[model samples]
Target: MTVLPNNLVFRSITGPEELELFNRLPYVQNDELADDLARGRRRPSWMWMALDGDRLLARLSWWCRPQDDAPFLLDLIDVDDSAHDVDRCAVAEQLLRTANAALFPDGVPVAQGTPPPEFLRFVPADWRADESTRRMVEDRVRAVERSGAVPLVERLRYEWFAGYPVPRPSDRLRFRGIESTEDILGLMARALDGTLDAHDRLDLQERSAEEVAAANFADEFANYDTPRTWWRVATLPDGEPVGFVIPARNAYHPIIAYIAVLPEHRGHGYIDDLLAEGTRVLAEEGVPNIRAATDVGNVPMAKAFERAGYDTISAVVNLTWEK
Candidate 1:
């Protein structure tokens, strides 16, 4: 094989060790991102690059599956916002070329190959707020367009960090973990009321709430990396159920797998009790961080997450085809 050089260059590096440098770059969610890649849930195509002497920037990441000759995912197209001297377009092109070589199913490059991999470039809506960021995104989008793929999915990435004091135990609400399967299914049915989210709506495909609960359990709950025993359900002293939270780790990150308050329970501060109890469970386990997200349009629940100290890491906008 022949190696090449450039005046302003970027190239691919194999294995986790070389990848670590890019992964550690500022603003990269290193550990959590690595967890996604390692699990085969996300893969970087070439781990693309840009350089001018010791100064460097990243342009795009392509996650592909060689078996299907498919481009599966793309993300983390970030850079040091202050470093605006380099040619953003050229950097995007060069980095994408690296992805072609390293990720092409037959070891071919995009320039001489079937075409560029179609991918999703995630950015906080503020990406184009400045020249460098805008240029970087523009060039990448143009490159993909030129390569015969569409700039398909656009999403928002949210974040929260720094210190958040745990809520003081509320006098009106007390919490405890659920113990038996029967109780879990019971609460889940009540929580189902007034739910408009897509995942919950999937419950309609089944004949009963128990069936709905079972399907949700297998697809989501059964796959968690954290203990189910940590899940909590909230209730009133008169034995009425209000809300619940299931804190667990999935393939992506540690998360609140499920949190809902019955429709009748909405507007009251019952959500605060549920959020605190859920977050407290993870905090008590000493997990350094947890990741969770909901529909951007779900205003109140989103607010609840912020109050409970969850910074939105990213927004997943879904697309589907059906009958």
Candidate 2:
């Protein structure tokens, strides 16, 4: 049996020390991300690293579910900054080939970017997003292309933060917590007619708009640690619904789940209140920080996030694979 380079040991680990080492690297190291893996919310077969003796050198990961053998998702990948003497690309390739050797033995592995599912609903209808995600979209393409497969779609990322906060909403708005899915979905269905969600866009293309709305509810909004009661719906004192904000924890962070208003309600600034209430709810939950992202061009919604005190954490570039 031919082994990998003797000097460098490549494998997966469940040890705290190794996990700590992986979390300390630059560029792709995220404590929350590492936490997800360590918590068994994500699996280790999809995560791997390259070590030289006791010193760490290169790393690669696939972000996928535990039930699957081939990790269609790729996560963090890094090389020791000081390893200038070693070919980084070679090590990266080795890591890719190593994973592909087993998980995708019968065919090539092609990767594209898909933002974590929870975020899709928040972007606006006209925003042209771009992800250009580094490893999953970029590295995956290079890795598979080397094996003769190709990526088929554009993996794009977009962002807005404190630098572009929306102005405070008009005084005509009052905020209230949501208690029922029926109420939330009503606002969402109307919002979807003008939303930027790619999945909904694809779904509505094939399924009835009503069915798309129902599936969207089950897939995204229905599951949350913070109840829909924490959601803030903006409305007129007379009871006309304007917009709403979801400050709830999905499978991961406290997210701005959905923020939308009727067309007639646009331009009056109900979003700021909605955004503020959402962030405040998450901050109260005791998480050190919250994460939210919006479309690059959803001027109004993007502005609301800024006004509400959330900062731009990072840009997540998303791409998807082809069948």
Candidate 3:
């Protein structure tokens, strides 16, 4: 428990009896909370809130995959929107610092996902042009920063709907099902050589590229609820591998789990072909929407998603705290 100003108290939910109290905060949907609890992605002890005489002032929660003993990310942090900016920031910073210290004493790296751009649009006009919304977002970010977290990268979330016009397949490359885990792992290694992925780049600072690639492979495979047959490798006429794509369903929806262009084949514009094949796979399955995300700074990949007719639905900001 944490002691706060004015006799405020910070504590975790004791059990299922506090579900309504946990869901009372804005931002998270009640149904989503119920689903997460039912699936074991969330636990009562992982949800913490700061209260001033039963009034919720701030809250933070961690989410993990089903059956995981430890949380993988801190996905939600909310402060009362009506509070003064300074007060809101103070509550947020204190809540995060104290909760993190208690929940992650070993200093595990925890990640935070900002609400998607569309979700943040409380008013109808463009959110980017909305000053009030922008300031509120910045304040939330600063609060996280005050807790010693750093911005890892900004990401673009894209969605392809059933009715959208999918790009015609490019004849420059041919696609085939992934033949073996070893071959896919090999391509993953090659994909990291000159990767533009911010997370991959950050990991490379202290670990070998191969080690980082292996870690990524394991993490990604763990979340894939769909069949491995959905994975594909793109190649040229001479049977040279150009790239690979993992079009699979995650815990919730169909997603382009991973897509990459080989370092040697990157500049040749083979990514568009890979994107097309990945989209076609999900589109052919009649999925209502296919979601994918790329680092905001990865212009080429972002352009490829756009060229494939995926809409830029939102932007996700990731803040990380590492031991």
> TM-score winner among the candidates?
3
- TM-score of every candidate relative to the true structure: 0.59, 0.67, 0.88
Model 2: per-residue Cα lDDT over 127-222, one tens digit each: 335352232234433544454334322222222233333334457678887757787777777777766655556566777766776777775676
lDDT of 3: 0.77
| Strongest candidate by lDDT | 3
Q: Candidate 1 lDDT, tens digit per residue, 160-194?
A: 33256665447676566786877787778766766
Lowest summed-lDDT stretch of 10 residues in model 3? 116-125
Whole-model lDDT per candidate = 0.61, 0.58, 0.77
Please give the distance, in angstroms, between residue 281's alpha carbon in candidate 2 and its true position after superposition.
4.3
- Model 1 spans with C-alpha error above 4 angstroms: 1-122, 125-163, 196-213, 251-253, 309-323
lDDT at 321, model 2: 40
Give the least accurate 10-residue stretch of model 2, judged by summed lDDT.
Answer: 115-124
Which ranking of candidates, highest TM-score first?
3, 2, 1
TM-score of 3: 0.88
**Per-prediction CA RMSD (Å):** 7.6, 7.0, 4.8
TM-score of candidate 1 against the unseen true structure: 0.59
